[model samples]
Target: MLRRYQTAICDALASVDGGSFCEDMWTRGRSGGGGCSRVLQDSTVLEKGGVNVSAVHGTLPPDAVTKMTCHGHHDLPAADGEGLQFYAAGLSMVIHPRNPMAPTVHLNYRFFQIFRRAPSERSGTNECGGEEATEGESLLWWFGGGADLSPSYVFEEDCVFFHEKLREQCDRCDPLYYARFKRWCDAYFRNHHRNEGRGIGGIFFDDLNENMTVSPEKFFAFAEDGLQTFIDA
Candidate 1:
C-alpha cells in the first residue's frame, strides 16, 4: 500500500509539471529498515514537495515507549526487557504549491507493531480452529493519521469543498467519524500562542484499530481517498 501511494502521489504531482519526482531510497540507522522518498521542486505548480514511505524496526527508547499511547502499550518493554521489538511504516506527504492560492497540504497514515521476538506466519493465524494468531510476545499495534489543508491565501469555497469531500469519505468508513474527527482536527491544528489556526480544518484521528471499533483495512482505504482528494483538489 505504501509503495502504491508513493507512485500514485508522485505521478499525480508530476502531472502538474512535465518534471518527474526525484527518488531517494534511504536506509535507517542501525540497518533497521529503509524507504524511498520521492520529491519534486521548483516546478510550475509545486515549489517543493515530497512523498515518502518508510518501514523501520528498532527498540524504542524507554521514555519514548512510555509516551506511545497507541493501544495502551505503556506496560510493554521499551528497551532491554522481555521484548523491545517495534516496527512502524507510514506514507506521509507534504505539498507546497508555487501558487499561494493553492494550499499546501499534508496527508499521513501509519501503522505500528510492538511485540516480542516472534516469527509468525503471514496469516498470523493459530492452528487451533484457525483462530487469529499473533507472533511471539505480541504487545500492541494500531493505526494513526489525518489530512489537512494549510492555505497562505484562504478561500472559503475551497475550505468548504475540501471539508465536504473528506467528510464524504469519512462517512463511508463510519457515519460518526466526521464530527468527532473534525473537532479533533480543529484542536490539533490550533496555534494557541497566536490564537489562530495554522490551516483550515480537516480530519485527525489516532489509535484506530479493531479494538477501537475500526478495522485497519477500512482506515487504509480512507487514507487512499484522502490522497486522491489532494490530487484532485
Candidate 2:
C-alpha cells in the first residue's frame, strides 16, 4: 500500500512538473529491510521534492518501549524485560515549488506493528546477523499520518482552499475527523519557543487503531483519499 502511495504521488508530481525523479535505493543493514527514494530537483514547477517509502523491522531498545508506554500504549510489555521487536512501513513526501507564492507541502502516512519474540527466537540470529524474530506474533499495531502546507507568504484564499479540501476529504470517512485532526494539526505544528504555528493547518492524526472506533481497512481508505486530496490541491 505504501509503495502504491509513493508511486502515485511521484507520478502525479512528475506529470505536473514535466520532470523525472531520480530513484535511490537504500538498505537498513542488520536492522532488516530497505526502501526507495525518488527525488526531483530544479524542475519546471518544483524547486526540489522527494517521495520516499520504507519498510523496516528491528528490535526496539528498552527506552523506546518505555516511551511508547508513556504515550498511552499501556498494552506494550514492560521495558525492563527483553526488547520488543517492531515492523514499520510508511510513505513520506515534501514538495518545494519553484514559485515562492506556492506553499511547501509535506505529507506522511505510516503503519507500525509491535511483537514479542519467543524465547528460542531471541537466542538466535538470522543470516544477516540480525535477530531472528521475524516470525514473532504481532501484539499491537497502529496507523498515523498527516498533510500540511507551509507557504513562504500566507495567502488567505489558498490556505482556505487547502483546509476546505482536506476537511471535505476527512468528512467522507467521518464528519468528526476534520475538526479533531484540524485542531491536532494546529497544535502539533506550533513552535513552542516562538509561540506560532508553522503554517496554516490542514489535517493531522496519529496512533489511530481499532480502539479509535475505526477499523484498519477504514483508516487505510482514509489515508488513500488523503493522498488524492494532496494531488488535487
Candidate 3:
C-alpha cells in the first residue's frame, strides 16, 4: 500500500513538473527489509521533492519502548527482559515548489506493529536473523499520519482552501476526525518561543488503532483518501 502511494505521488509530481524522479533502493542490514527513495530536484515546477517508502523490522531497545509508553503507547510489549520485536512501514513525502508562493507541503503515513520475542528468538538464534517473531503474532499495532502546508508567506485564502480540503477528506471517514485532528495539528506544530503555529494548520493524527472508535481498515481508507487529497490540493 505504501509503495502504491509512493508511485501515485511521484507520477503526479512528474506529470505536473515535466521532470522525472531519480530512484534509490536501499536495504537494512542484519535487521531486515529495504526501501526505495524517489527524488526530484531543480525541476521546472518544483525546486525539490522526495517520495519515499520503507518497511523494516528489528528489535527495539528498552529505552525506545519506554519512550513510546510515555508517549501513549502503553500497550506496547514490554522490552525490559528481552527487547520487543517490531515492524514498521511508511510513505513520506515533501515538496518544495519552484515558485515561492506555493506552499512547502509535507505528508507522512505509517503503520507500526509490536510483538513479543519468543524465548528461542531472544537468544539471537532465530533463522531470520532475530528480526522475525517465531509465533508471528502481533501484540499491538497502530496507524499514524498527517499532512500540513508551510508557505513562505501566509495567504489566508490559500490556507483556508488547504484546510477545507483536508476537512472534507477527514469528514468522509468520521465527522469528528476533522475537529480532533485540526486541533492536534495546531498544537503539535506550535512554536513555543513564538507562541504560535509554524504555519496555518491542516490535520494531524497518530496512534490510531483498533482501540479507537474506528477500525484499522477505516483508518487505512482515510490515509488513502488523504493522499489523494494532497495530490489534488
Candidate 4:
C-alpha cells in the first residue's frame, strides 16, 4: 500500500529542513479509514499551517462520487451488488498567516485506486487540458498534487516567481502545460459559496499520471523541489 511509502516521505521531509518548525497532529474517523494530519509553523514566517497525511480505504459510496461533481470529472466503478475496494494515502497542507501581506499557501498530493479499469470510463477528453494527451487508460491509477498561493495583497513579482517555478517543472515536459494549468488553478480555488477566492492565486494542478513527462519519481522530485521553493519564497 502507498501508506508506508507516504509515511517514509513525511519522515524524510520532517527529518530534514522541517524538523526545526513547530509541529501538530490531527486525525478523524471515516466510514472506511481515518487520516493523520501534521503541521509545522514558524512564528516569523507562518502564523499557522498543517502538513496532513491520510491513509484511508473503502468503497466510494454514491454520495462520495457526487461530492466530486464540482470537479466536472467523475468515473467511478459500476454499482455492482458488491462494493469497490479502494486505498489512498497522501499529504495536504494549508498555511494561514497573521500578516496578510505574506500570502497564504495550500498544497495537496494524493494517490488513489479502483478495483480495476473500466472500459466505459470517460477519457478526460476536454481540449482545454494543460497537457495535451490521449485517453483510454484509467485515471483511477493516478496521483494528483499541486501547491498554490493566495495573497490578500497582490504581489505581481511573487505571483510571477511562484508560477515560474511551477512552470519550470511543467515546461520540462510540455511548454503549454504550465500556462494551461495556471488558469485551471485560478479557476479552481474559489469559495463559491462566498463568491471569492482564498487569495490572489498562485498555481494548482492535479490528476497527473505516469504517462505525463513527469514520471512518478520525477513528479515527486518536482513536488519536493517546489515545496522548498515555497518555503524560501
Candidate 5:
C-alpha cells in the first residue's frame, strides 16, 4: 500500500515539476522498510526541493525515539512497546522562487501507521506477530497531512487567503480541525535558531486516518481543493 501510493504521488508531481527527478541517498531503516527520496535541484519552480516517500516498519530504534523526542515529540508512541508497523507516503517540497517576490512555499501530505497487529493480523506485517497481535486484535489507524506557505515579504492577504482556504477544507472535515492545526502549524514552523520563523506561517498536523469521522475519500477531495487553492493563489 505504501509503495503503490508513493508511486502515484511521485507520478503526479513529476508531471508538474518539469525537471528530471533524482532519488536521494537515504539510510536503511533500523526497524523495517525503506523510503524513496526524490529531489529536483534548481527546478523551474523551486531551488532544491524533495518529494520523499517512506514505507518503513518495525520498532523504532532507541536513537530514533530520542531524536523524535528532541523535536518535541512528546506524543510519539514508545519504541519498544509493541514495535510499530509504520508506513508513510507524502510529498514535501519547498519552492524557492527565482523571484524573491514570490514567497517560498512548503507543502506536505502523508499517511501514517502505528502498532496494530502481527503479520498474520495485518497483511503488511512480517511473520513475527507481537504479543498484542497474538491476543487477536488490530491496531488503531489514522492520518495526518497539511500544506503551509511562507512569503519572504509578508503578504497579509496571501497569508489570510492561504489559511482561509485551508480553514475551509478543515471546516468541511471538522470545525475544530482547522483552528487546532492552524495554531499547530504556526508554532511548528518557528525557527528557534533564528529566533523567528522560516516564513510567515501555514499549517501542520499529524495522526489522521481513513477511519476519521470524515471519510478518506472526502478528505482526499478536501486536500485536493486545498492544494489547488494554494497553487492558484
Candidate 6:
C-alpha cells in the first residue's frame, strides 16, 4: 500500500507544476531496512514538498520501549541492556504551495510491530534480529496516522468540502470516527503560543488498534480511501 501511494502522490504533485521530484534512496541505521524520499523544491505551484516511505527494523534502545507503555511490554526487553526487535513502515507527505490560496496539506499512514528477542540475544549472547524473527515471532502490532490541512486564509467552501468528504469516508468504517478523530486532530495541531486551532481539523490518531473496534484491514482501507480522496480535493 505505501509503495503504491508513494509513486501516485509524487507523480500527481509534480505533474501540475512541471517540476520533478528527486528520489533519494537510503538505508536506515546500520543493518536496518531502507526507504525512498521524493522531494520537490522551488516549483511553479509548490514552494517545497516531500513524499517519503521507509521500513526500518533494529534493536530498539531498551529505554525507548518503556516509554511506549504498550501491551506485552514485559515480553520485550526493558531495563536489560539488550533492546527489543522492532519494525515500522509508512508513507508520509507534506506540501507547501506557492500561493496562499492553496492550502498546505499533510498525510501519513504507518504500521508498527514490536517483538521480543531471544534471551541469549538480549544478553548479547546471540545477535539481535539475527534471522530469529523470520522463524515466526510477533508480539504486538498496530496501525496509526492521519491527515490535516492548513490555510493562511480561511475559505469556508474549501473547509466544508474537505471535511465533508472526510466525514463520508470515516462513516464508512465507523459512524463516530469522523467526530472522534476530528477532535483529536484539532487538539493535536493547536498553536500553543497563539492559543488557537492551527487550522480546520481533519483526522488524527495514534495507537489505533483492533481494540478500538476496527480490524487492521479496515484501517488500511480507510487510509487508502483518505489518500485517494485527497488528490481529488
Report each candidate's C-alpha RMSD, comma-separated, in the order given: 5.9, 4.1, 4.2, 9.5, 6.3, 5.1
TM-score of 1: 0.83
lDDT of 1 by residue, 93-163 (tens): 89899888889988888878777664343343221112232345657677788898899889899889999
Candidate 3 per-residue lDDT, tens place, 116-186, comes to 77323422322212243243566778888899988988899898899899989988988999999989989
Query: Which scores greater on lDDT, model 4 or model 6?
Result: 6
User: Which parts of model 3 are misplaced by more than 4 Å?
Assistant: 118-135, 210-214
Candidate 5 residues lying further than 4 Å off, grouped into runs, are: 1-18, 23-31, 61-84, 120-136, 192-195, 208-233
On residues 75-193, what C-alpha lDDT tens digit does candidate 5 reach at each position? 55555645444444444555555557777777766655444343444344322211222222324444566777667778788777777777777787678888788788778878888
Model 3 per-residue lDDT at 2: 70
- What lDDT does candidate 5 reach at residue 184? 86
Q: How many backbone clashes can be found in candidate 3?
A: 0
- Whichever of 1 and 5 has more lDDT, that candidate is 1
Question: What are the lDDT figures for the candidates, one per model?
Answer: 0.74, 0.82, 0.81, 0.57, 0.58, 0.76
**Highest-lDDT candidate:** 2
Q: Candidate 5's C-alpha lDDT?
A: 0.58
* Ranking of all candidate structures by their TM-score, best first: 3, 2, 6, 1, 5, 4
Q: Is candidate 4 or candidate 6 better by TM-score?
A: 6
| Model 3: colliding residue pairs | none
Two-way TM-score contest, 2 vs 4, winner: 2
Question: Compared with the true structure, what per-residue lDDT tens digits does model 2 show for residues 1-233?
Answer: 66667778888888989999998877687546667889999989999999988876777889999999999999887854668888777889999999999899999988888878733334354322244444577678898899999999998989889899998999999899999999999999999999999888778899888574556789888888888888787
Off by over 4 Å in 6: 70-80, 118-136, 212-214
* Model 1: how far residue 99 lies from native, Å: 1.5
- Report the lDDT of model 2 for residue 199: 80
Angstrom error at residue 96, model 3: 0.9
